[model samples]
Target: MTGHDRAPGSRIDTSKPHPARMYDWWLGGKDNYPVDEEMGRKLLAIEPRIPIMARANRAFMQRATRWLAQHGITQFLDIGSGIPTEPNLHQIAQRTAPEARVVYCDNDPIVLAHAEALLRSTPEGRTAYLQADVRDPADILERARDTLDFTRPVALSLIALLHFITDEDGAYDLVDAFLQGLPTGSYLMLSHGTGQFTPKGAAEADELYKNSGITLALRDRHEVERFFHGLELVDPGVAVIDTWHPELGEPVEGQQDFQPMPGFGAVARKV
Candidate 1:
């Protein structure tokens, strides 16, 4: 179910712009191709602070993980895990709680190629990788169950990922399936792109991604909150990514002057 745990040099499509590789380019990583960089550059032209937005999104992941770990949630199931970013979800959670168990899942084979770096867990903690799509909730849950104890509460993180999933693809259904599979007290954490702040820029970016064969399903604040339905949302419910729990982590610089990077982030308990 892991990248290294699979056949070597397996299915990797370099033709299209995948979420993982494009995300890598956004994070200034060298794992992406020229196509990804081209698209990323286009996005940057529209939103100059894209790298800052990426960092803010990543910081949100870390803070949310830390909050969950501090609240007694030691297991994590992170879907749509992009290219191996430093201080990944596992690192943040395990750092706070040494015994944290993390399961990283992504549909991209390129991410699988670098899954080893993600697997480097603390001796007291555990980490595993799964090559799967977020749409396949049953398979992810089944595979993650091998490494995580579903009987206990888990922190499900979909950071900067759900935007790639369009409504036609049942984004809400996928979330519900995963939440339904988890026990009570489990948590659902997510940061998604939105168009509320800059509609024109968001539209341009969406068109660019569409031409590149990628889906950019940016949702509004209200729509993003739909994913947390039936769950008890934590404080600062469904705010811009940088605004949510800014006290818990370092704030993204120059964020105050910008046009409010259009995105929504929140963490909710599955009661």
Candidate 2:
């Protein structure tokens, strides 16, 4: 369900699997229900290294945050912020730059339920959470201004988020809308699932998600890169998530043995 449709205190759906909850299950978090676990297991059967991939994705977020913070960008707007796994985007950013300000937006009620963990910023930093979806960029940007300064540079993070939004859903248009509000030097950090590695398995996974009433738009490398059309890519442009910047963080164990995590990640500047 989209965030606009769900009101505050809305009941969490326990019948079907959700992408956020399933991701939490894959990361070994205890906040997921049986339905999430069932789907997680099913996905695991399809891609046994999904847990490793999840860890790799988290590591990518952490490393990207560090890179942004190190480059003097102290404000962040992370959309599609999933369940707060430890060392979240704010924590990583504030660790590098204590005065950093962050605004997190997510549509999942489950994420809102555990948002307390995401709000614990350092005394010198600030963090706020908004229960909003990526589809509604205007509302998100308006509310985010309470915590972030729109006139200044703000890093926009969309890690592991766009694969759920298909081309028909205006993924590129939504990104442009978000970037349009930010100033020059603002960054867009993204990591999206791709079908380049194993086309057959990706197709099967898409079918499974489609049957479960979820959209899984696994794009190729070229299509994924097109999301950053006008933005200037950072060094090592659009590499596999794990290979983006290995020097920036420790490697996820057994990541090298896997099939490159079936994704692409990159950081780019708006200028």
Candidate 3:
């Protein structure tokens, strides 16, 4: 693994909220700051199911990682990986396939600060973390090559990450670049926030994020599927986050009681 690129004693911006920190708060983690808590609480006020959605999103990550492991996919490139929670991507993959290799990348300095928890790997496997952004697909792909074999099938997960990237930022093109860099049989796994179910509420959430200096690129189901262009979507093609193969893993508590989270998730093969 390469050395930590970020300098020690980095100043974490506690004045403004950040996605990773807010997500950490939503997941009931302590790595978040008060600013994050304030924003998360506001979001909850807007949508009471925010925490459930976070857990549901996390459940998707776990199930998808397990599926990839069982399907003989031993390499993972998970970008936009938020603050580490227990049984993270490596934990799930390594449990099913001890030899699975995982490389996690995120632009957040806080993620880098807590990256030690993410680096612990089983003796038979490997894990690495990169301090980078999703917009720079080439850098991520090039660095991931150090731990992952691009020649083989890899599950590239962008879970709950794309909403932060907008069209003007070349979101689709970045995905295409990453997919293009991988060999055939590689998979693209993603979960994206959408405005489909509740456009007004979603717009309000977007406004809040915008005012807080965050970007929420909420897309509809069709637009989210566009990121998988040319790939063969797996069974149960892009549906609400909770609908993608609920049978594969334990259903999130109260997930069925609430309106489907305004997000879609799917896994597809490059073919």
Candidate 4:
């Protein structure tokens, strides 16, 4: 990782479940608590393909980051960066553009704790982590500037994040705020969880999270597309997560078996 400041970890709440921890649990990681595993397993029972979806989502991120890096976009600002998974944003980007610089932000203290130890940057590249929420775009931008140059283009990644943010929380406005601070050449690369494929299961999952004191606002295709209203979407616009640039990705088991994958993914440019 780069020399960016690693803020001290906040108290981890083991009382209830956090989406990040549950995600870790699904990915076969041991950083989660019993509460997280309980909820994660319940959700898995509802949608057994979740583990497949999670792995496919990571593959999409790798493809998107590689697309950006190969296109000469060297800086990245990834918000809602969950637990430090393997082949992280920097590792993917720096593979093509060795000088790539990345800034990963997340509100969970667990991400900061593990990211600092697990996320490694190439000798020619840099990586940094910020313990912050996506709602605080100004603060994130400020801290990100320590490693990335805002004057140039950056790929603002919101993969598998916005669905957790409700419209009441100003999801669109939050995205606009982040994009506003970036230049014309900048991009918004995002993947959103959706209920379009199976509304009943999605509703059950949403209700379960609400009962667990978590917000799960799964949007449909049109609503997800609305996030990129003012921007220009890349080719095969807003395709299913696994379908977007599949040639750039390796074969993910069950990816082809599952039609549509219950989410949308896209990469759009400011101008």
Candidate 5:
């Protein structure tokens, strides 16, 4: 809610590319505009493995969800949840725990337009969508409480999200604030795009996004690790996205040929 919900069929800006739409395009979804495809193709030229990386990021989310669910964690707060794709977080979590409660937050209007797909939940479980941004964690936590219980252990996921928020934008502070609302035993699952493997490609991609009026703040492994400062990193700490718990899910094709997918992922518990 948070008064960010738009009326059905609200105007969607097609003049430029949006991160959500571009991501949807990369995922081969049909919810994006032509401009998004144009930008996606341009990025693909810079990094041919982007689509594979996108799938790898999604697999990381699912694997982390399964891990949390297997550990008896049922509640989830997923921020910067992009356009809905198959086997969403709730679907992956609720498969193990039927009564899992999930709250998804996103600021993209197009996501709100298709949030109905995200609202579908198992009869025993619950799902809610909040049209909000990660910058305003207070409003997100307040609205998310309608479905998620902060007093209990909740898995907080920020997959492929923080890179859009720079340190100057208080990315670290916002993450700390969100974690502060959860109690002990809660988990933080995050995956961020990094420039470690391909610094020149990253710079070109960042500049391309900047020219398109989008912010792409790719970080290194050490910078990404900073987000999980006080938490206990799970086994294989801060490894490449696809390398973390590959057994929990199927491997993304063409991933083996790429150079570590140019991203990092890890899950940690707030003990």
Candidate 6:
């Protein structure tokens, strides 16, 4: 079962490509428009290994979610939960802890349209969706409370998010605000795009997104680690998404071909 969909009236915009839809395109999903494909193709032209990156990122999330579940984290609040894919966070979490509860939030109306896929919780668990942006952390945290108990430990998953948010937009402050709401022992799981290894290619991709009216801020390792400040980072600290905990999940088909996936992933606990 799932909670009610709380979306302030907003129409699905197809004129411009959305990050989530473009991401869907990268993942070979059918929930994207031509505009999104056009943009996705352009990005792929810059880096042919993008599809591998997409799958590797999902694999990282799966491994991280399973690790958290095995470690006794039963509640998940996944903000920026994009278009639903198979074996979502709830599935991985509830597989270990049947009574686990998950709340999915995303700003995209397209995701809201397909929210049902995210709501099919197991008989022993619960799921909910919220059509909201991460910028409005307060509103998301408040509504999420309806499905998740804030007093307990909740793993906040920000997978493949945050790069869209610029420092001018208070990205650090936003992360801090969400962390403040969670009690001690809560965890933050995040994956961020970086321009470190492929600086030239990363710059070109950033320009492409900028031209398409999207803000893609690929941070360096130091900048990405800033979000985990004051938290106890898990072993190996921040790492290339695929390398974080490879033993927890199976390998992606083309991940080895691409070397590093140009992203960093880490899980940190609030002490």
Q: Which predicted model would earn the best lDDT?
A: 6
lDDT of 3 by residue, 112-205 (tens): 8898988889888899998888888898899888899887888899999989989999899999999999999999999988889989889899
Model 5 per-residue lDDT tens digits across residues 122-161:
8889988887778988888888887887778999999899
Please identify which of the two predictions, 1 or 3, would achieve the higher lDDT against the true structure.
3
Model 1's lDDT to the true fold?
0.86
lDDT of 2 by residue, 1-271 (tens): 0112224666789999999999999898998999989988888889999999999999999999999999999999999999999989988998889999988888888888888888888888888888887999989899888888888899999999999999899999999999998899899999999888998889889998998899999988899889899999999989899998889999999898986678899999999
Q: Which stretches of candidate 3 lie over 4 Å from their true place?
A: 1-10
Lowest summed lDDT across 10 adjacent residues in model 2 is found at 1-10
How far residue 165's Cα lies from its native spot in candidate 2, in Å, is 0.5
lDDT of 1 by residue, 1-271 (tens): 2222564557888777777787788888999988788878888899888888888888889888888898999999998888998988888998889888899988788888888989988888889998877888998899888889998999899998888889999999999999999999999999999888888988999999898888899999889999999999999889888888887788777777655767889999998
Off by over 4 Å in 6: none
| Candidate 1 ranges with C-alpha deviation above 4 Å | 1-4, 7-9
lDDT of 4 at 199: 91
CA lDDT for candidate 2: 0.89
lDDT, model 5, position 217: 90
lDDT of 4 by residue, 101-179 (tens): 9998888877777876435788888888888879999999988988998889999999899999999999999999999
lDDT of 5: 0.89
On the 0 to 100 scale, the lDDT of residue 68 in model 1 is 89
Error at 257, model 3, angstroms: 1.5
Deviation in angstroms for 216 in model 4? Answer: 0.8
Per-model root-mean-square deviation over C-alphas: 1.8, 3.1, 1.5, 1.2, 2.2, 0.9
State each candidate's clash count.
0, 0, 0, 0, 0, 0
lDDT-better candidate, 2 vs 3: 2
